[model samples]
Target: MVIEWLTLMVPADWHERFIAADTAIWTHFLAQQPGYVGKQIWRNPAKPDELTLLIHWQSRQQWKAIAPTALAAVEQEFRQNLGRSFDIIAANEYQPLADGSISSQRPMAD
Candidate 1:
């Protein structure tokens, strides 16, 4: 499987809103793609503003196949809705040592 790994820095005061926007981009945009498996959001206590996202896909090629235009739209929506760009620390892809299955999906925020 392929994973999209991203580290972001968002203000503590914007935590819930940031999560909502981020989750919307993932669930509403990425999840609509052909091979999306799941996504996970992680928070760092040491640096409250630090957040990490892992987006799983069936394969690297499938994930890369996502149309650039669609991605741009989602990013545009994120910025327009959230009012700021997340300070991205790291963004990359990875292959797990062993391809595993996720039994359950993340609960979407209302």
Candidate 2:
């Protein structure tokens, strides 16, 4: 399994808007993608402006296939259409270890 971790630093005032945008995309993925297993969205406990997205896929290829189109929509539609909402800081990706762990040996909590 592969996990795509997207850590975004968003503007504080636009949190709701960001969530709305993400929710839309999440719904889209759930409906159209068979390879998408699940996803989790997180926010920094300390920093209100930080958000983290964990997307699980069946394989890297499945993820890569949908990534470009989804990302382009997020960039062109969400970002451009709603620049007043927030500023995206960064995004990253990772593969699970043999033990099904990415950052730690322990399993991620539900």
Query: Evaluated with TM-score, which candidate comes out highest?
Result: 1
**TM-scores vs. true structure, each candidate:** 0.84, 0.69
Candidate 1: global Cα-lDDT? 0.86
In order, candidate lDDTs are: 0.86, 0.72
lDDT of 1 by residue, 82-105 (tens): 888887899998988853457555
Query: Best lDDT goes to which candidate?
Result: 1
Predicted structure 1: clash tally = 0
Error of 2 at 48 (Å): 1.5
**Model 1, residue 39: what's the lDDT?**
90
What lDDT tens digits, residue by residue, belong to model 2 across residues 6-58?
77878667777778876775546454776788888788979887888888888
